[model samples]
Each structure stands twice: as structure tokens, then as C-alpha cells.
Target: MLPFTYALRNLFRDPARLLQTVGGAALVVLLLIAAVALNEGMNSVLENSGSTKNVILMGKGSEESIERSEVPLSAESAVATSVRGLQEVLGVSAVSGEIFYQAPLHIAQGKESQALLRGVLENALLVHRSVQLIDGRFPQSGEVMVGHLAHRKLGVAEEDLAVGESLYFGDTELKIAGRFIAPGTVLESEVWFDRNDLAVLTQRDSLSSVTVRMDAAEFEDVEVFTLQRNDLELAAISEQGYYDKLSTFYEPIKVMTWVTAALVAAGALFGGLNTLYAAFAARIREMATLQSIGFTRKALFVSLIQESLLATLTGTLVAFILGYFILDGLAVPFSIGTFTLTLTPSVIGVGLITGVLLGTIGTLPPAIRCLAPSLPSALRSS
Candidate 1:
């Protein structure tokens, strides 16, 4: 059997080829890391956005989209009084009637972009435990509060969303009274206004949804209330269940991410294979000589695989460093809100496994072809 050093030394025989192989493999691993990070970050945002103790009551057919759901303005009071076992916060029933809207918000005199708007009463803070006022005070009528990432989503400078600055809604200007944060959730990318102000601006006569916080064991009571109130035409869903459904709805996008990674990785795989083929073909005589000296064909094949793995593993290290420094914690905006790309341990594990597969699978065909001929034939050919 050949010494392992033989495989290691062979990799440096052609510096340019070694660099190319490593670079190509690194790029492929990086693409895979990006894809996996995207999936992880998106799922994390949606999963953390909900709580087991909360329930959402939305229009019957609009369970999937709270923004499209509508309940009567009277339902808020009715549900608070009718629903039993709701958690109380600061002497108020933890029930919030919310209105969701998306429209072009004027950032400047002429520039405007779409932004998510939420209308809620003071009880919103009680119902959504994740929300915290980071600056100034909660919004009042004719004023609005901006989320931490609202400026980024609106394509405006962060300074433009400062506490004293103002944003336009339709023909009316609303002051930015405060800034709030809801880390790891989509709420960080929205603008909040007084429910009455939003209803007047959008001419919306009904509420978007009713959110309530209650004991998990008492969810049946809430469900039964929704069932009995045929007049409201509302459906009840646990907050966690709602977000889980949202995650499922976005499954195809994650699948598409994998598909895109596969396509790009396939291209890089061929390029790496071509490099390996050339590198190995140049070492054919050396391999034949080794075989003649009693190094078994099996040993030679193993050495070839070892050389490929070394190059690919180096590339994998570079990919991890790049992912940690550049991609991790990078905020990516979506229609609902923004999520930060996370380089979690699981994502890194996927990248490492992908690197191993690339090294092993990529070397098989080229290694097999290079050793196909007899030792004498291989030595005599070149």
C-alpha cells in the first residue's frame, strides 16, 4: 500500500490546478450554505412568531392570511365578554382587534414603496408579548410607530423613520411617535397605527383579526365560542398552529432554494471533475509505476479519493468562514417582514456533508477511468 503522504504530495504537483479545484469546490459549498441558511432563517422567523397560549380568530376562509380576514368592529367586545378563561394583563383582557394593510407609503415628496401596516389598540402590547417599545412612546391617534426594520423594508433611510419624523398615508401625514422591536419575528418590519386612524385612512369598516392570549388547556372554549357564534363567521386557530400553517405554505419556496442550489452545484461538480480528470491523467505513469512495485490497484484508487477529499475539505473550510462572516445575521426582507440569515450548527453540518459527497462522488468516475487500462499499457501510452 502507498503511504498517505503520496496522495497529499500529489495535490501540489500543479499549483494552478489545485487552486482551481479548491476554488470551485468552495463556491459550490458556499451556494449550498446560502440555500440552507435561507431555509433555516425563514423557518425560524415564522416558528418564533407565534405562541402556544395565543389564539387568532379570523374570517372563516381567510385563516391562511390574517391581512385578508375581516371581523365586525363589534366582535372585539363580544369575544372579550363571551370567551372564557382568557389571560388578563394589567387589568385588561388580553384580546386585541387588529387591522392589517399593505400599501405604497410615501417616504419622500415623490418616492413611495410598499410597506406592511398594522392597526391595533393599546392591548396589542399585552396580547403580543414579544413587542417592546425601544424608544419614545406608543403611538396615539394621528401618529404611527415604526418597527426596527420598517425603514429598510420601506426603502427609506433609517434616519427618515426616526421618532420625530413623519410618513404619509394616503393624503394624511402621520408622526413617528416611537420605535419598537420584536426580535426574530415578522413584527419587526411593520408600522403600527391607532386602529381608528387606519380604519379611517383605508376606509376599512371591519377588523382584520382578533388575537387573544389564554391558557393552552382552555383552547377548546375559544374554539367552541367560534363555532357557536355563527353570526361572526370566524374561525379559531392557535397562534402556533397558524404560524405552522404559514411555514407549510412557504415550503415550496424552500424547495425551490434547494433546487437552485442543486443546479448551481451540478455545474460546479462538472468543473471540478474536469480538473480532477486532468490532474489524475497527468499522474497516470506515476500510478502505473506504483502498481508495478506491488502497490495494489485498490490502494491507488483509495489514494485518488484521498487527494480529492483533501482539496474539497480545504474548500469547505473556506466556505464555513465566509458563511459565518458574511452571510450570518444578514437581514433578508420579504413581503411579510425580514428574517436574518442564520449560520446555525445544523446549517454548517449540512455544508460539511455536502462537501464530503462532492469529494467522494466527484472522484469516482475520473479515478475509475484513469486506472482502467493495464499497468503496462498506461506506462507505455505517455
Candidate 2:
């Protein structure tokens, strides 16, 4: 058996070739990792937005996004009184009526941009713990709470977002009372206000949807009742399932990722194969000399494989560190939406496995082809 050092030294013999082959492989691995992480991060953003005990009540045909749905505000009292197993706090059932709208917000003095508007009661915040105020106080009626991302986009500092500062949206002058954060979720792109205030502002006394906090036992009853109700055209679904539907919102992104990864891997695999074939072909005489001196073909193949594995593994390690520290945390800007790329444990595992697999698959054929020559021919050629 050859020493591992012998195989490694051969790979480093031509620094330029080593760099090119490893770099290409690393680039492929990085691209794959980025795509996987993006999917997971987006999934996480949606998945983490809801709790298992919470149920969303939307118009019968509506899915997760309430912006596209409409439900009468009176539906709240009906669900509270009708749905059995519904818990209560302070005399109110574990249900909250809410409204969601998209409003044009003028953050810049002379420019206007659009932002999602969410209107819910104080009790709604208690039910959805994801809404955390990082600064100031919660917004009162005629006031608004901007999300952390919204604040950054608007270039509004905590001090600048005073309780009395006016935010002009449509004909309403909304007061800035607080700043809240729901990290990694779509909520970060919204401004929140009181439900009643929003109803007056938007001129829609009706709500977009209703959210209910029910026990595990209540989910079935609530779902069945909401669906079967003759008076109201409403449906109930798990909040998690609702957001999972948003994955379609990211369909183009997911497709683009898969296509880009396939192309990159294909290019990298071919480049790696070419580099390995050339390197092994040049060493035919050397391999033959070793064979004549008692080195087995199996041993030569193993040595070449080890060299390929080492290079790929090195590149994978470097790429992982770079992707996590530099690329993953970056906030990618887009016209439709923006999110930070994240690298989780699953992504790292995939990248490493891909690198090792690329190494084994790319170099095996070339190594075997070079080793096909007889020992005598190799020695004579040498």
C-alpha cells in the first residue's frame, strides 16, 4: 500500500492545475450548498411563523395569505361561540379577528414604497409570540409599529420613530409608536396597527382572516365546523400548513436554483475529470515502474483516488467556511421580497457529501484507464 503522503504530494506537484481543479469543484459545491440553504431558510421562515396550537380561519378558498381573502368581522363572534374546546382568557375565547392589507408607505421624504399592513388586537400578540418588540412601545390606535427590516428600509432609527412622528399612508397620518421584529419571517416587511384603526383607515370594517388558539383536541372540531358552516364561507387550517403554501411563491427561485446547480456540477465534474485524466496519463511510466517493482493495479487506483478525495475535501472545507461566514448571512435584495441567506446544519452536510462524491466519481474512470497498461510496456516507455 502507498503512503497517503505520496498521493497528496502528487496532487500538489502542479500548483496551477491543483488550484483550477479544486476551485471548480469548490464552486460547484458552494452553489449546491447555497441553493439548499436558500430553500431551507425560506422554509424555516414560513414554518417558524406559527405555533402548533394555533389555527388560521380564512375565507373558504383562501390559503395562507390573508391579503387575498376577505372575511366579515362578525365571523369572529360566530367562531368563538360555535367552536367547542375553544379556551378563553379574560372572558374572550382563544380567537382573534385580524386584517391584512398592502399599503403604500412613504418612508423617504419625497418617495413612496409599498409595505404590508397587519392589524391585530393586543390579545393577538399574546397568541403569536413571534411578534417581539425590540424597541419603544406597542402602537396604539392611530399609531403604527414598523418591523426591523421596514425600519432599515425606511432608514428610520429608534429615536426617529417617536410616538408622535407622522407616517403618511394614503389619506391617514399614522403615528410611529414602536419597532417590532419577527426575524426571518415575512412579518419583517410589514407595519402593524390596531385592528379598529386599520378598519377605519382602509374603509373595510370586515377582516381579512381570523386566528384561533385551540388545544390539540379542538383542531378537528374547528376545522370541520368552519368548513361545514352554511352561514359563513370559511375554512380553518394549521398556521404551518398555511405558510408551506407560500413555497409556491418561491417556485421560480427554487427552479432557478436546481437548474444552476445542475449546470455547475456538470461543468465542474468534467473539468475535474479532464484534470485527473491528464495528471494520471503523465504518470503512466511512473505507475508502470511502481507496478514492475511490485505495486498492484488496485493499489495504484486507491492511491489516485485518495489524491482526488484529498483535494476535494480541502475545497469543501474552505467553501463551507466561506459560505457560512460571508455568503449565508448576507441580505439578498429583490424587488418582490428580500431575505438573508442562511446556512444550517443540513446544508453543511449536503455540501460535504457532494464534494466527496464528486471526487470519487470524477477520478475513477481516468485512474483505471491509465492503469490498464502492462508493467513491461510502462517500464519500456519510462
Maximum-TM-score candidate = 1
lDDT digits (tens) for residues 1-382 of candidate 1: 6789988998898899889888988999999999989998999999999988999999999999998999998889888999877888667899999999999888655669899999998999988999999998999999999999887788777888999888898789899999999989999999999999999999999999999999533788888899889999989999999999999988999999999998998998898888889877877888898899888889999999998899999999999999889998888888888899988888889889988988898899989988988988999968
Cα lDDT for residue 298, candidate 2:
89
Worst 10 residues of 1 by lDDT: 215-224
- Colliding residue pairs in candidate 2: none
Index of the highest-lDDT prediction: 1
Number of colliding residue pairs in each model: 0, 0
* Regions of model 1 farther than 4 Å from truth: none
Against the hidden reference, what TM-scores do the models get?
0.95, 0.87
Give the per-residue lDDT digits (tens) of candidate 2, residues 80-126.
Answer: 88887666677767788889887667652545666678898877775
